[model samples]
Target: MSSAPTPAPGTSTYRERLVPGPAGVAAVVLFAVMCGLVVLVSSTVAAAITSLTVLVVGLVLVAVTSPVVEVRGRELHAGRAHIPVDLLGETEVLDADGVRTALGPGYDPRSFACLRTWTKGAVTARVLDPADPTPSWLVSTRRPAALRAAIEAARGA
Candidate 1:
Protein backbone atom coordinates (compact mmCIF):
# COMPACT_ATOMS: atom_id res chain seq x y z
CA MET A 1 0.00 0.00 0.00
CA SER A 2 1.16 3.53 -0.76
CA SER A 3 1.98 5.74 2.18
CA ALA A 4 -0.22 8.81 2.82
CA PRO A 5 1.21 12.16 1.87
CA THR A 6 2.43 14.41 4.65
CA PRO A 7 0.94 17.87 5.15
CA ALA A 8 3.07 20.96 4.71
CA PRO A 9 3.53 23.19 7.70
CA GLY A 10 1.35 26.33 7.91
CA THR A 11 -0.75 25.15 4.97
CA SER A 12 -4.50 24.49 4.86
CA THR A 13 -3.93 21.29 2.89
CA TYR A 14 -4.46 18.00 4.75
CA ARG A 15 -5.00 19.77 8.07
CA GLU A 16 -7.40 18.41 10.67
CA ARG A 17 -8.09 20.41 13.80
CA LEU A 18 -10.86 20.50 16.36
CA VAL A 19 -13.41 23.25 15.87
CA PRO A 20 -12.58 24.37 19.42
CA GLY A 21 -15.54 25.58 21.47
CA PRO A 22 -17.28 25.10 24.82
CA ALA A 23 -19.62 22.46 23.47
CA GLY A 24 -16.91 19.83 23.08
CA VAL A 25 -15.52 20.35 26.58
CA ALA A 26 -18.96 20.34 28.10
CA ALA A 27 -19.87 17.15 26.30
CA VAL A 28 -16.81 15.39 27.66
CA VAL A 29 -17.50 16.50 31.20
CA LEU A 30 -21.16 15.57 30.94
CA PHE A 31 -20.35 12.13 29.63
CA ALA A 32 -17.90 11.55 32.43
CA VAL A 33 -20.45 12.60 35.05
CA MET A 34 -23.14 10.42 33.53
CA CYS A 35 -20.85 7.44 33.48
CA GLY A 36 -19.94 8.02 37.08
CA LEU A 37 -23.58 8.19 38.04
CA VAL A 38 -24.27 4.95 36.23
CA VAL A 39 -21.51 3.26 38.17
CA LEU A 40 -22.81 4.58 41.47
CA VAL A 41 -26.32 3.29 40.89
CA SER A 42 -25.44 -0.21 39.77
CA SER A 43 -24.16 -3.51 41.24
CA THR A 44 -20.41 -4.20 41.18
CA VAL A 45 -20.46 -6.31 38.05
CA ALA A 46 -23.01 -4.13 36.29
CA ALA A 47 -21.12 -1.01 37.26
CA ALA A 48 -17.86 -2.34 35.89
CA ILE A 49 -19.41 -3.36 32.57
CA THR A 50 -21.47 -0.20 32.16
CA SER A 51 -18.64 2.06 33.15
CA LEU A 52 -16.25 0.43 30.72
CA THR A 53 -18.76 0.63 27.90
CA VAL A 54 -19.59 4.25 28.61
CA LEU A 55 -15.95 5.14 28.84
CA VAL A 56 -15.21 3.67 25.44
CA VAL A 57 -18.21 5.34 23.77
CA GLY A 58 -17.59 8.62 25.53
CA LEU A 59 -13.94 8.68 24.51
CA VAL A 60 -14.88 8.06 20.91
CA LEU A 61 -17.29 11.00 21.00
CA VAL A 62 -14.62 13.15 22.59
CA ALA A 63 -12.20 12.22 19.84
CA VAL A 64 -14.72 12.96 17.13
CA THR A 65 -15.87 16.27 18.58
CA SER A 66 -12.42 17.33 19.67
CA PRO A 67 -11.64 18.14 16.08
CA VAL A 68 -14.51 20.37 15.08
CA VAL A 69 -13.32 20.48 11.53
CA GLU A 70 -10.51 19.04 9.45
CA VAL A 71 -9.29 20.21 6.08
CA ARG A 72 -7.70 17.27 4.27
CA GLY A 73 -6.56 18.48 0.89
CA ARG A 74 -9.83 19.46 -0.83
CA GLU A 75 -12.09 17.72 1.68
CA LEU A 76 -13.59 19.17 4.86
CA HIS A 77 -14.42 16.77 7.67
CA ALA A 78 -16.64 17.81 10.53
CA GLY A 79 -18.18 15.79 13.40
CA ARG A 80 -18.97 12.48 11.72
CA ALA A 81 -19.60 14.27 8.45
CA HIS A 82 -17.43 15.00 5.43
CA ILE A 83 -17.87 17.15 2.35
CA PRO A 84 -15.77 17.78 -0.73
CA VAL A 85 -14.55 21.35 -1.15
CA ASP A 86 -15.80 21.41 -4.73
CA LEU A 87 -19.25 20.27 -3.69
CA LEU A 88 -19.74 23.23 -1.39
CA GLY A 89 -21.60 26.13 -2.94
CA GLU A 90 -22.98 29.23 -1.18
CA THR A 91 -22.60 29.84 2.56
CA GLU A 92 -24.64 31.85 5.05
CA VAL A 93 -23.89 32.94 8.59
CA LEU A 94 -27.06 32.83 10.64
CA ASP A 95 -28.07 33.99 14.10
CA ALA A 96 -30.63 32.22 16.32
CA ASP A 97 -33.58 33.71 14.53
CA GLY A 98 -31.99 33.27 11.17
CA VAL A 99 -31.17 29.65 11.89
CA ARG A 100 -34.72 28.90 12.97
CA THR A 101 -36.11 30.59 9.89
CA ALA A 102 -33.71 28.92 7.52
CA LEU A 103 -34.02 25.48 9.05
CA GLY A 104 -37.81 25.76 8.84
CA PRO A 105 -40.07 23.24 10.56
CA GLY A 106 -39.04 19.91 12.17
CA TYR A 107 -36.11 21.58 13.90
CA ASP A 108 -35.27 20.09 17.27
CA PRO A 109 -32.46 21.58 19.25
CA ARG A 110 -32.11 18.78 21.85
CA SER A 111 -31.00 16.15 19.36
CA PHE A 112 -27.25 15.82 18.78
CA ALA A 113 -28.26 14.86 15.28
CA CYS A 114 -28.74 18.58 14.73
CA LEU A 115 -26.16 21.23 15.59
CA ARG A 116 -25.63 21.62 19.33
CA THR A 117 -27.98 24.18 20.86
CA TRP A 118 -25.15 25.79 22.81
CA THR A 119 -23.92 27.26 19.54
CA LYS A 120 -24.53 31.00 19.46
CA GLY A 121 -24.89 30.89 15.70
CA ALA A 122 -24.39 28.68 12.67
CA VAL A 123 -22.84 28.44 9.22
CA THR A 124 -25.20 27.08 6.59
CA ALA A 125 -23.60 25.38 3.61
CA ARG A 126 -25.23 24.97 0.23
CA VAL A 127 -24.67 21.72 -1.64
CA LEU A 128 -23.99 21.75 -5.39
CA ASP A 129 -26.04 18.72 -6.32
CA PRO A 130 -29.72 19.36 -6.76
CA ALA A 131 -30.57 15.71 -6.27
CA ASP A 132 -28.95 15.57 -2.85
CA PRO A 133 -31.62 15.45 -0.14
CA THR A 134 -29.46 17.35 2.32
CA PRO A 135 -29.50 20.73 0.68
CA SER A 136 -27.64 22.43 3.54
CA TRP A 137 -25.98 21.68 6.85
CA LEU A 138 -26.23 23.89 9.94
CA VAL A 139 -22.90 23.93 11.73
CA SER A 140 -22.52 25.30 15.23
CA THR A 141 -19.55 27.60 15.51
CA ARG A 142 -18.15 30.25 17.81
CA ARG A 143 -17.24 32.21 14.70
CA PRO A 144 -19.74 31.55 11.98
CA ALA A 145 -18.46 34.34 9.75
CA ALA A 146 -14.90 33.08 9.82
CA LEU A 147 -16.00 29.50 9.17
CA ARG A 148 -18.10 30.65 6.25
CA ALA A 149 -15.21 32.57 4.78
CA ALA A 150 -12.85 29.64 5.17
CA ILE A 151 -15.29 27.23 3.50
CA GLU A 152 -15.96 29.73 0.74
CA ALA A 153 -12.26 30.21 0.11
CA ALA A 154 -11.69 26.45 0.03
CA ARG A 155 -14.54 26.00 -2.40
CA GLY A 156 -13.17 28.80 -4.60
CA ALA A 157 -9.81 27.06 -4.75
Candidate 2:
Protein backbone atom coordinates (compact mmCIF):
# COMPACT_ATOMS: atom_id res chain seq x y z
CA MET A 1 0.00 0.00 0.00
CA SER A 2 1.16 3.52 -0.69
CA SER A 3 1.83 5.74 2.33
CA ALA A 4 0.97 9.40 2.85
CA PRO A 5 3.56 12.08 2.27
CA THR A 6 4.65 14.65 4.82
CA PRO A 7 3.37 18.22 4.59
CA ALA A 8 4.78 21.56 5.63
CA PRO A 9 3.93 22.75 9.10
CA GLY A 10 0.94 25.06 9.61
CA THR A 11 -0.16 25.12 5.98
CA SER A 12 -3.70 24.63 4.72
CA THR A 13 -3.98 22.66 1.47
CA TYR A 14 -7.73 22.45 0.98
CA ARG A 15 -11.09 23.72 2.18
CA GLU A 16 -14.55 22.69 0.94
CA ARG A 17 -17.70 24.65 1.71
CA LEU A 18 -20.81 22.67 2.65
CA VAL A 19 -23.67 24.91 1.66
CA PRO A 20 -27.30 23.88 2.06
CA GLY A 21 -29.28 23.10 -1.10
CA PRO A 22 -32.10 25.19 -2.57
CA ALA A 23 -34.60 22.61 -1.37
CA GLY A 24 -33.32 22.95 2.18
CA VAL A 25 -33.55 26.74 2.03
CA ALA A 26 -37.02 26.48 0.56
CA ALA A 27 -38.13 24.14 3.34
CA VAL A 28 -36.93 26.61 5.92
CA VAL A 29 -38.82 29.38 4.21
CA LEU A 30 -41.95 27.23 4.00
CA PHE A 31 -41.79 26.54 7.70
CA ALA A 32 -41.38 30.25 8.41
CA VAL A 33 -44.36 31.03 6.16
CA MET A 34 -46.50 28.48 7.95
CA CYS A 35 -45.56 30.01 11.25
CA GLY A 36 -46.45 33.42 9.92
CA LEU A 37 -49.81 32.13 8.66
CA VAL A 38 -50.66 30.83 12.10
CA VAL A 39 -49.83 34.23 13.58
CA LEU A 40 -51.62 36.01 10.72
CA VAL A 41 -54.91 35.40 12.52
CA SER A 42 -53.72 38.09 14.96
CA SER A 43 -51.53 41.00 13.64
CA THR A 44 -50.07 41.53 10.15
CA VAL A 45 -46.92 43.39 11.11
CA ALA A 46 -46.10 41.02 13.97
CA ALA A 47 -46.57 38.00 11.71
CA ALA A 48 -44.34 39.49 9.05
CA ILE A 49 -41.64 40.26 11.59
CA THR A 50 -41.83 36.75 13.08
CA SER A 51 -41.58 35.15 9.67
CA LEU A 52 -38.55 37.25 8.70
CA THR A 53 -36.83 36.52 12.01
CA VAL A 54 -37.41 32.78 11.67
CA LEU A 55 -36.23 32.75 8.06
CA VAL A 56 -33.02 34.61 8.83
CA VAL A 57 -32.24 32.54 11.91
CA GLY A 58 -33.01 29.27 10.16
CA LEU A 59 -30.74 30.09 7.23
CA VAL A 60 -27.94 31.14 9.58
CA LEU A 61 -28.31 27.92 11.54
CA VAL A 62 -28.14 25.81 8.40
CA ALA A 63 -24.96 27.53 7.29
CA VAL A 64 -23.38 27.39 10.73
CA THR A 65 -24.14 23.71 11.30
CA SER A 66 -22.75 22.59 7.97
CA PRO A 67 -19.61 20.52 8.42
CA VAL A 68 -16.31 21.84 7.12
CA VAL A 69 -13.72 19.80 5.20
CA GLU A 70 -10.15 20.97 5.03
CA VAL A 71 -6.61 19.71 4.70
CA ARG A 72 -4.50 21.74 7.11
CA GLY A 73 -0.89 21.13 8.01
CA ARG A 74 -0.47 17.32 8.02
CA GLU A 75 -4.05 16.38 8.84
CA LEU A 76 -7.32 16.05 6.93
CA HIS A 77 -10.19 17.60 8.84
CA ALA A 78 -13.79 16.66 8.18
CA GLY A 79 -16.47 17.97 10.47
CA ARG A 80 -15.19 17.41 14.01
CA ALA A 81 -12.90 14.52 13.08
CA HIS A 82 -9.39 14.63 11.70
CA ILE A 83 -6.59 12.25 10.74
CA PRO A 84 -2.94 12.63 9.93
CA VAL A 85 -2.10 12.75 6.24
CA ASP A 86 0.69 10.28 7.00
CA LEU A 87 -1.98 7.72 7.86
CA LEU A 88 -3.72 8.08 4.50
CA GLY A 89 -2.76 5.88 1.55
CA GLU A 90 -4.37 6.61 -1.82
CA THR A 91 -6.71 9.47 -2.69
CA GLU A 92 -9.37 9.34 -5.38
CA VAL A 93 -11.62 12.07 -6.78
CA LEU A 94 -15.18 10.83 -7.25
CA ASP A 95 -17.91 12.02 -9.57
CA ALA A 96 -21.65 11.82 -8.88
CA ASP A 97 -22.00 8.16 -9.91
CA GLY A 98 -18.88 7.17 -8.01
CA VAL A 99 -20.18 9.01 -4.94
CA ARG A 100 -23.47 7.13 -5.10
CA THR A 101 -21.69 3.79 -5.36
CA ALA A 102 -19.17 4.64 -2.70
CA LEU A 103 -21.91 5.60 -0.28
CA GLY A 104 -24.08 2.70 -1.31
CA PRO A 105 -22.93 -0.69 -2.65
CA GLY A 106 -19.18 -0.17 -2.15
CA TYR A 107 -19.40 1.20 1.35
CA ASP A 108 -17.54 -0.25 4.30
CA PRO A 109 -19.19 -0.10 7.72
CA ARG A 110 -16.00 0.91 9.44
CA SER A 111 -15.22 3.78 7.10
CA PHE A 112 -15.76 7.43 7.96
CA ALA A 113 -18.13 9.36 5.69
CA CYS A 114 -19.05 13.05 5.85
CA LEU A 115 -21.90 13.19 3.40
CA ARG A 116 -24.04 16.13 2.30
CA THR A 117 -27.10 15.73 0.11
CA TRP A 118 -26.35 19.01 -1.66
CA THR A 119 -23.05 17.72 -3.01
CA LYS A 120 -22.73 15.15 -5.81
CA GLY A 121 -18.94 15.01 -5.85
CA ALA A 122 -16.65 13.49 -3.24
CA VAL A 123 -13.18 12.31 -2.36
CA THR A 124 -12.17 8.92 -0.97
CA ALA A 125 -8.92 8.26 0.79
CA ARG A 126 -7.63 4.94 2.09
CA VAL A 127 -6.60 4.95 5.73
CA LEU A 128 -3.23 3.26 6.10
CA ASP A 129 -2.98 3.10 9.86
CA PRO A 130 -3.01 -0.48 11.12
CA ALA A 131 -4.02 0.56 14.61
CA ASP A 132 -7.14 2.41 13.53
CA PRO A 133 -10.34 0.55 12.70
CA THR A 134 -11.49 2.97 10.01
CA PRO A 135 -10.64 1.63 6.53
CA SER A 136 -11.07 4.90 4.69
CA TRP A 137 -12.77 8.30 4.48
CA LEU A 138 -15.49 9.27 1.98
CA VAL A 139 -16.26 12.95 2.23
CA SER A 140 -18.76 14.89 0.11
CA THR A 141 -17.37 17.98 -1.58
CA ARG A 142 -18.39 20.43 -4.29
CA ARG A 143 -14.87 20.54 -5.65
CA PRO A 144 -13.85 16.92 -5.99
CA ALA A 145 -10.85 17.41 -8.24
CA ALA A 146 -9.49 20.21 -6.10
CA LEU A 147 -9.91 18.17 -2.94
CA ARG A 148 -8.15 15.19 -4.50
CA ALA A 149 -5.36 17.41 -5.74
CA ALA A 150 -4.96 18.96 -2.31
CA ILE A 151 -4.75 15.62 -0.59
CA GLU A 152 -2.27 14.33 -3.16
CA ALA A 153 -0.15 17.45 -2.91
CA ALA A 154 -0.16 17.34 0.87
CA ARG A 155 0.75 13.67 0.79
CA GLY A 156 3.50 14.26 -1.74
CA ALA A 157 4.91 17.14 0.28
Candidate 3:
Protein backbone atom coordinates (compact mmCIF):
# COMPACT_ATOMS: atom_id res chain seq x y z
CA MET A 1 0.00 0.00 0.00
CA SER A 2 1.09 3.54 -0.56
CA SER A 3 2.32 5.43 2.51
CA ALA A 4 0.24 8.17 4.07
CA PRO A 5 0.97 11.58 2.65
CA THR A 6 2.96 13.85 4.95
CA PRO A 7 1.16 16.79 6.53
CA ALA A 8 2.58 20.25 6.00
CA PRO A 9 5.38 21.43 8.27
CA GLY A 10 4.55 23.48 11.38
CA THR A 11 1.04 22.05 11.34
CA SER A 12 -0.84 18.86 11.97
CA THR A 13 -3.47 17.80 9.45
CA TYR A 14 -5.51 14.65 9.06
CA ARG A 15 -7.76 14.49 6.03
CA GLU A 16 -10.00 11.81 4.56
CA ARG A 17 -11.77 12.22 1.23
CA LEU A 18 -15.00 10.28 0.66
CA VAL A 19 -15.73 8.95 -2.84
CA PRO A 20 -19.00 7.85 -4.47
CA GLY A 21 -19.56 4.11 -4.09
CA PRO A 22 -21.13 1.77 -6.66
CA ALA A 23 -24.58 2.09 -5.11
CA GLY A 24 -24.37 5.88 -5.05
CA VAL A 25 -23.11 5.90 -8.65
CA ALA A 26 -26.33 4.22 -9.83
CA ALA A 27 -28.14 7.54 -9.39
CA VAL A 28 -25.99 9.13 -12.10
CA VAL A 29 -27.15 6.60 -14.69
CA LEU A 30 -30.75 7.01 -13.60
CA PHE A 31 -30.46 10.76 -13.96
CA ALA A 32 -29.00 10.44 -17.45
CA VAL A 33 -31.77 8.12 -18.61
CA MET A 34 -34.52 10.33 -17.20
CA CYS A 35 -33.09 13.40 -18.92
CA GLY A 36 -32.70 11.54 -22.22
CA LEU A 37 -36.24 10.13 -22.06
CA VAL A 38 -37.77 13.59 -21.86
CA VAL A 39 -36.45 14.34 -25.35
CA LEU A 40 -35.87 10.89 -26.87
CA VAL A 41 -39.37 10.64 -28.47
CA SER A 42 -38.75 13.84 -30.40
CA SER A 43 -35.11 13.53 -31.57
CA THR A 44 -32.23 11.13 -30.94
CA VAL A 45 -29.71 13.97 -31.10
CA ALA A 46 -31.60 16.01 -28.52
CA ALA A 47 -31.89 12.96 -26.30
CA ALA A 48 -28.17 12.29 -26.56
CA ILE A 49 -27.30 15.90 -25.75
CA THR A 50 -29.69 16.00 -22.79
CA SER A 51 -28.30 12.71 -21.48
CA LEU A 52 -24.75 13.98 -21.68
CA THR A 53 -25.62 17.27 -20.04
CA VAL A 54 -27.52 15.65 -17.19
CA LEU A 55 -24.76 13.08 -16.60
CA VAL A 56 -22.05 15.72 -16.49
CA VAL A 57 -24.08 18.03 -14.25
CA GLY A 58 -25.12 15.18 -11.98
CA LEU A 59 -21.56 13.94 -11.64
CA VAL A 60 -20.31 17.40 -10.79
CA LEU A 61 -23.04 17.88 -8.20
CA VAL A 62 -22.19 14.55 -6.60
CA ALA A 63 -18.48 15.32 -6.63
CA VAL A 64 -18.90 18.74 -5.08
CA THR A 65 -21.27 17.50 -2.39
CA SER A 66 -19.03 14.57 -1.34
CA PRO A 67 -17.66 15.03 2.17
CA VAL A 68 -14.13 15.61 3.36
CA VAL A 69 -13.40 15.34 7.06
CA GLU A 70 -10.18 16.95 8.15
CA VAL A 71 -8.46 17.98 11.34
CA ARG A 72 -5.94 20.73 10.68
CA GLY A 73 -4.07 22.84 13.19
CA ARG A 74 -6.71 23.72 15.76
CA GLU A 75 -9.85 23.07 13.77
CA LEU A 76 -12.05 20.16 12.77
CA HIS A 77 -13.62 20.43 9.33
CA ALA A 78 -16.57 18.21 8.47
CA GLY A 79 -18.17 19.20 5.20
CA ARG A 80 -18.77 22.96 5.17
CA ALA A 81 -18.61 23.43 8.94
CA HIS A 82 -15.42 24.03 10.89
CA ILE A 83 -15.00 24.19 14.64
CA PRO A 84 -12.05 24.84 16.91
CA VAL A 85 -10.20 21.84 18.27
CA ASP A 86 -10.67 23.04 21.83
CA LEU A 87 -14.42 23.08 21.31
CA LEU A 88 -14.39 19.45 20.21
CA GLY A 89 -15.33 17.01 22.93
CA GLU A 90 -14.72 13.29 23.27
CA THR A 91 -14.60 11.46 19.94
CA GLU A 92 -15.72 7.88 19.57
CA VAL A 93 -14.91 5.46 16.77
CA LEU A 94 -18.01 3.51 15.79
CA ASP A 95 -17.76 -0.12 14.71
CA ALA A 96 -20.02 -1.71 12.09
CA ASP A 97 -22.92 -2.28 14.47
CA GLY A 98 -22.33 0.98 16.22
CA VAL A 99 -22.33 2.75 12.86
CA ARG A 100 -25.66 1.17 11.94
CA THR A 101 -27.25 2.26 15.19
CA ALA A 102 -25.86 5.75 14.84
CA LEU A 103 -27.25 6.02 11.33
CA GLY A 104 -30.55 4.46 12.29
CA PRO A 105 -32.76 5.18 15.30
CA GLY A 106 -30.03 6.81 17.36
CA TYR A 107 -29.38 9.44 14.72
CA ASP A 108 -30.15 13.02 15.67
CA PRO A 109 -31.82 15.11 13.01
CA ARG A 110 -29.76 18.19 13.86
CA SER A 111 -26.36 16.52 13.94
CA PHE A 112 -23.92 16.89 11.05
CA ALA A 113 -23.26 13.67 9.20
CA CYS A 114 -20.83 12.88 6.41
CA LEU A 115 -21.88 9.32 5.85
CA ARG A 116 -21.01 6.93 3.03
CA THR A 117 -23.16 3.89 2.25
CA TRP A 118 -20.06 1.78 1.54
CA THR A 119 -17.92 2.58 4.57
CA LYS A 120 -18.93 0.59 7.59
CA GLY A 121 -17.16 2.58 10.27
CA ALA A 122 -17.35 6.18 11.43
CA VAL A 123 -16.05 8.66 13.98
CA THR A 124 -18.28 10.99 15.93
CA ALA A 125 -16.93 14.30 17.19
CA ARG A 126 -18.86 16.00 19.93
CA VAL A 127 -19.59 19.60 19.17
CA LEU A 128 -19.35 22.24 21.89
CA ASP A 129 -21.57 24.66 20.06
CA PRO A 130 -24.58 24.63 22.31
CA ALA A 131 -26.22 27.40 20.29
CA ASP A 132 -25.81 25.56 17.01
CA PRO A 133 -28.30 23.05 15.66
CA THR A 134 -25.78 20.24 15.18
CA PRO A 135 -24.76 18.39 18.29
CA SER A 136 -21.91 16.47 16.73
CA TRP A 137 -20.32 15.35 13.49
CA LEU A 138 -20.50 11.74 12.37
CA VAL A 139 -17.94 11.23 9.65
CA SER A 140 -17.76 8.04 7.61
CA THR A 141 -14.33 6.56 6.98
CA ARG A 142 -12.79 3.25 5.94
CA ARG A 143 -10.12 3.68 8.62
CA PRO A 144 -12.14 4.75 11.60
CA ALA A 145 -9.49 4.09 14.20
CA ALA A 146 -6.86 5.97 12.24
CA LEU A 147 -9.20 8.90 11.79
CA ARG A 148 -9.92 8.96 15.49
CA ALA A 149 -6.25 8.71 16.35
CA ALA A 150 -5.40 11.54 13.96
CA ILE A 151 -7.99 13.78 15.54
CA GLU A 152 -6.63 12.99 18.97
CA ALA A 153 -3.09 13.57 17.88
CA ALA A 154 -3.96 16.86 16.21
CA ARG A 155 -5.86 18.01 19.28
CA GLY A 156 -2.97 17.09 21.49
CA ALA A 157 -0.52 18.94 19.26
**Which predicted model would earn the best TM-score?**
2
Model 3's number of clashes is 0
Name model 1 segments beyond 4 Å from true: 1-67, 106-114
| Per-model TM values vs. the true structure | 0.55, 0.90, 0.74
**lDDT tens string, model 3, 28-143?**
97979898999999999999999999898888888898878777766767778777766768889998898888878777888878788778889887788788677888888888
Local distance difference test values of all predictions, in order? 0.62, 0.87, 0.79
Per-residue lDDT for 24 in model 2? 87
Better of 1 and 3 by TM-score: 3
lDDT of 1 by residue, 69-127 (tens): 55555555667777776777777788988777766776544322236666667767666
Worst 10 residues of 1 by lDDT: 7-16
Which model, 2 or 3, shows the larger TM-score? 2
Local lDDT at 77 for model 2: 90
Pairs with steric clashes in candidate 2: 5-155
